[model samples]
Target chain A: MAGASFGYDPRRPVLRGIDMLVPRGRVVAIMGGSGCGKTTILRLVGGQLRPQEGSVRVDGQSVPDLGRDGLFALRRRIGMLFQFGALFTDMSVYENVAFPIREHTDLDESLIRDLVLMKLHAVGLRGAAQLYPNELSGGMARRVALARAIALDPTLVLYDEPFAGLDPISLGVVGQLIRQLNDALGITSVIVTHDVYESLKIVDYLYFVSAGRIVAHGTPDEVRRSTDPFVRQFVDGEPDGPVAFHYPARPYAEDFGIRAS
Target chain B: MTSVATGLRRVGAGTLRAIARVGFAARFFVAVVLQTPAALRRIQLTAREIYFAGVLSLVVIMVSGLFVGMVLGLQGYDVLVKYGAGDSLGIFVGLSLVRELGPVVAGLLFASRAGSAITAEIGLMKTTEQLSAMEMMAVDPLARIVAPRFWGGVIAMPLLAALFSAMGVFGAYLVGVRLIGVDDGTFWGNMQASIDFWPDITNGIVKSIVFGMAVSLIAVFEGYDAHPTAEGVSAATTRTVVGASLAILALDFVLTVFMFRGLGNT
Candidate 1:
């Protein structure tokens, strides 16, 4: 993505003049506080939303320029694990993993079954295939979603808050799996998250966003060692920083008539 | 003068919102229409939805049809007996069921039962991000999800209407012939003579089809456009019933005028 800007409502842009790159066979993390346009970047990468300015290019092709059919065609090469897993509740775990394969391929049931089981096995949930999404625990659902994301053997995988609601063990498992999967499958992975420590341990590089733009980006050690106040504030989880703790608003005292306006 | 300006502004804003809603609905209809051919390939999904939207609605429709027919029979018997034309009860009941009550009542019941369910289901799916997930997977949610349900509702409406009409005729028979002592031959004979195959029966089916399209489109569109929250899903489901019920009634009048009045002369 180059100089990409976007917003849900055109009058209030969320992401502004952001630029980033993800090299193949590497796990890159986009880290930010909530509502910092981390997920918006993933949306643009997946062609789910168009950038208001500049472009999101995947494989040297601009995303927003693609027509409907062209966009779907491009999307087939990409996989995304949404926040909360977003499993089809009506379908079983096995069916959830098999959905994209069935929709995009003419593979027979036997092959599809084998492929689904293999993907589930890779995520250590092969036995949970018969269960519904509602039956699975949060971590299990996220793992199943991870299995599904890699089912198509996509060239690029985007993870949105994969570690959000996971326990420490599950988080560690997911963080390791993300690193392992990218390396083993030779696929580029971009994870949007706020779990700074876990992400720093596994990611090849990190981009820390504040107010929709990247404030600092480097290898984990370099990011940690940087003296930039914004980066330092975020890295150390400080209460006060260049990014204010409070929203811009009217004065507290004047509203109570204790002081002149 | 300020009050007048405020009222005018409110009216203008309301009109613009209404226009925007109509435009959004039109676009949704077109998207569903275009995706229908692809949805056909996934017939099992559509069949399952038909069972939910159609087969599950059978009991309510059947019972309502029966009760409505019985009331019509009782009312018609009272009037016809006064006029010494008691045997014409079947003609009255049959004409009402085939020409108006069958399609309209079935449609209202369907909007309450099936249309509301469709909206809630889709709205919940949106809340859970399943639709967005499908889009990310390179599967058009309109083709996979909305179109199947749309076609399912369309296919189910006519069949349910037919069933309601048949049940209604039976209910009418039980009251008019067995209960009221109307001559059996006169009852059957008058109905056969009075109800035209082309104008009454076919036009009723046509009305059901149009109602089906309107209700299903409104249901799915509201669901698709709903805010992704619990309150949003609840509100969308409410709008589905209210909007579809109003659309069914309004469309019924327009269709009755066009199909019965204009076509009756020809």
Candidate 2:
């Protein structure tokens, strides 16, 4: 994406003049504080939302220009793992994994069965295929969702907050799976996350967003060594820096009538 | 003076918002209609929705229809006896059920039950990002999710109305003839003469179909437009019930006007 701008409300843009690139067959992370438009970028990339300005291009094709059919065709090549997995609660794990394949292809039930089981096995959830989404643990559900995302063998995979709420072990496992999947499938991966440590561990490059622009970006080592205050504050988990510790507001004394208005 | 101005402004704004909301809903309805042909390709999904929205509503409709018919029968018998027209009790019961009561009452019941359920289910799906997930998977949620439910409701409404009318007639028979000692032959003979298959039955079917489309459209549109939050889903579910019920009643009145305007002339 280049010079992409978007906002749910026109008066207040969430993402502004943004530019980013995901190299082929590499894992890249877009990280920022909460509400910094991280997820908006993912939506733009997935063709779920059109950028108000500039362009979001996936594989040399402009996304916003695509009609409904073109968009869906483009989406078939892009896999997105939403935050919280977003598994179909009504469907069994196996059916959820098989949904895209069934919707997009004419493969018979037997081949679909084999393909679904293979995807489940990769996520180590082959035995959980019969269970509904509500029956699975959070970690198990996320893994099932991961399996479903790759069901069509998409060339691009997007992960939105994949480690927001997970036990340490589960987090580590997910981090490992993300890295392994990208390499094993030869797919380009873009992960939007705030888990700096885990993300730095897995990602080949990082883009740190602040107030809707990429304030800093580089290799993990380069990012860690950067002297930029905002980057340093985020990387070191500091309490104060170029980013304020508190929201902009009126004076506390004036609000309490301690001073004349 | 300022307060008066503010009140007028608020009312004007509210009117405009209502119009916009209706426009939005109409567009959504058209989109779902356009997508229905594609949705039919997934016949099993539409069948499942019919089972959920139509088959599951059978018990309530059946019970309510029976009770409503019994009350109508008893009341009609009492009134007709005062006028020495007790033999025409079947005319009263059949006309009421076939023309107005069956379609309107069944529609109200359906709006409360199946329409609300569809809205809540879809709203929850939105809250959980399942709809978005489908979109990301190259599937149109409108085609995959909303269209099937819309068509299912439309197809089921007329059938459910017919069932309700049938049950209601049976209940009326039990009260008017077997219990009240009204002449059984007179009851059957009067009903047969009074209820025309086209004017009475067809109009009711048409009313139910229209009500079904209105209610289902409102339900799905509310769900699709719901904010992806717990409170938002709850609010959308409530709106679906209120909006669908009102739409059904309003549409019934308009349809009644049109249907009865040139009754004997037709």
All candidates: TM-score of chain A: 0.97, 0.97
Q: Which residues of candidate 1, in runs, are more than 4 Å off?
A: B1-11, B263-266
RMSD of 2: 1.6
Candidate 1 lDDT, B1-266, residue by residue in tens: 99999999999999999999899889989989999888788899899989999999999999999988888888989998999889889888998898789998999999999999999999999999999999999999999999999999999998888889989988989999999888899999999988889888999999999888888888899899999999999999999999999999999999888887765443
Each model's lDDT comes to: 0.92, 0.92
Candidate closest to the true structure, highest DockQ: 2
Model 2 agreement with the true structure over B75-117: per-residue lDDT tens digits? 9999999999999999999989988899889998998899989
Real A-B contacts recovered, model 1? 0.82
Per-model TM against the reference: 0.96, 0.97
What is the DockQ for all candidates, taken in turn?
A: 0.85, 0.92
In candidate 1, the residue pairs with backbone N, CA or C atoms under 3 Å apart (3 or more residues apart, or in different chains) clash, namely none
Candidate 2 clashes between residue pairs 3 or more apart in a chain or in different chains: none
